[model samples]
Target: MVKQTNVKNRKLICDKLLTFQTQLEADYSDKLYEVSRKRYAQIDDLENVHTGFKSAVKREVKSLIPFSDIYKETIKLSFERVDAQYQKVEREYKEIWKEYSDNLSLNWSILAPAVEGMATFCGKVMRVLTSSNEEIDVSKLKSILYLKELNL
Candidate 1:
């Protein structure tokens, strides 16, 4: 997966990577470039991989340029870098989800008393309206179109 969840970025990265691959092949050996391309081809979602790939390529090429295609070590490092980024993104998502859940629970806890208070007030109003209490002139309230005032 890419670092970002959006579509346009993934496409841009892929395009940049393709151009970068052509340049690397021209600058370096074909075998080395092919190894890099093969490693990248395996990944399905290439979000934030552009940055990771660049870093990994720099490190790998710097270390391996003088020598022959040290295929496994060089390619594996790049793969590790990309995979690490994927893991990091997943971890970040989980942390955000946990924070959201915690906030929702806290909100429910805080609002519970307020909800109860509203219910109590509604009960008190109904009692005043229904009871023949002289203190509350219930007749002063507006009448509903189809409802007659109830006699207690």
Candidate 2:
């Protein structure tokens, strides 16, 4: 058991959470989002209206589709151009999601302990400050965090 009479005796828990969130966001943007952007850059055509598709392929197909319309050939390939790159974009998107998920998992893993550690430290400090009570058993706090590995 522990006790503290003064409000100033305890540290604010909100500050710890805010710091964790800020660091997580920074790491996600730097480590995950940046890498994902690079992957997407490989497939993205930065020239014109085509964002998700390679520019050369889209331009070539667009030129051919107009002729296909007049010739009654109906290649129907222009609209389907993006479908070809769909897998690549999908892969990029998936990686980004996986990275974000990984970062979140990592953040939680670190934060859970950080918070618990602060609480434990604060508990002891306040305990000593206000009383000389015996220490409580904190075995369960050291337990592992079991998480399901989902098929991504």
Candidate 3:
């Protein structure tokens, strides 16, 4: 009778653990999906901002920069800085996804790092972009060339 009770208790514990694991997996997967979707949308908006900035620069800077060597260099440096900012964000985004996928299991708590990294990455791109604009602005460049308003 004791042996039967021990086996039943073990079975009950195992069943409870399995249920918890299943729920955790579902919850983690849902959270990841939702966050990734929002991040992707943000990336799309960033791309649009980049496109608009590029178009404005091409149209405005091309005609303006020829007159001032300092302005030309400033614009070039600004473009490079913006590109680097984009690459950093992209790298962090990929790293989070890779980390999640590689350690995927019942460990939903592991997502804290990924989620925090995601949250921290937010607004950084724009910050970099706008700071670059400051340098451009000092050169007396057009305000239209700056990413003053984010699409988001």
Candidate 4:
């Protein structure tokens, strides 16, 4: 009877462990998806900002014929707008890094064995963003990606 009870308890523990593993995997996968989506959105925003800046530069050049204090002011404002957009992008990158860092910190205990897996996921994401064919350059985004890719 004691042997049967021990077997039953072992089975219960095994089942619980399996459930925990599954949940952990799902959580990590969800995080990866979220990060990928956010990265893509940031890329889109960067493209839009680049396009707008180019257009503003073209406009300024065309208005050189009517160069005046007003035109100069308009150019100055456009430049400032571009600066603001770059700053916003920088802020967003930092936010994403923080989010990933927080999530990893939260799950560290439960995901110790899966640390390498998580790092691989992050590395793949970085590769996708840094690829030459990628629409947006993310070379500067490597630090955040690498940190998240660390084997916890």
Model 3 lDDT at residue 105: 65
lDDT of 4 by residue, 1-152 (tens): 99999788656544443443343334333323444465334444444545543453435333331435434544455445545655665677779878877777645677776886886788678657753232333222332233223321
Which residue pairs of candidate 4 clash?
Answer: none
What is the Cα-based TM-score of model 3?
0.36
TM-score-superior candidate, 1 or 2: 1
lDDT of 1 at 7: 65
Best-to-worst ranking by lDDT: 3, 4, 1, 2
lDDT of 3 by residue, 1-152 (tens): 99999788656544443443343334333323443355334444445545444455545544543435434554565566555655666677778768977886666677968876886676675445533222111122323223121110
Flag clash pairs in model 1: 2-47, 2-48, 3-48
In model 4, how many backbone clashes occur? Answer: 0
User: What is the lDDT, from 0 to 100, of the residue 144 in candidate 2?
Assistant: 7
lDDT of 3: 0.47
Global lDDT scores for all candidate models: 0.41, 0.35, 0.47, 0.47
Cα error, residue 36 of model 3, in Å, equals: 9.6
Q: Which regions of candidate 4 deviate over 4 angstroms?
A: 1-52, 59-65, 105-152
Candidate 2 wrongly placed segments (more than 4 Å): 1-75, 99-152
User: Quick one: ranking by TM-score, best first?
Assistant: 3, 4, 1, 2
Per-residue alpha-carbon lDDT of model 2 for 40-91, expressed as tens digits? 3322222121232223333433343333332122123322433344555557
List, residue by residue over 1-152, the lDDT tens digit for candidate 1: 45566466545544443443344433323322332243222122223233434454555444433323333433454455445655665566468658865776555787878987996787567545543212222122122111122110
TM-score of candidate 4 to 2 decimals:
0.35
Q: Cα miss at 46, model 1 (Å)?
A: 9.3
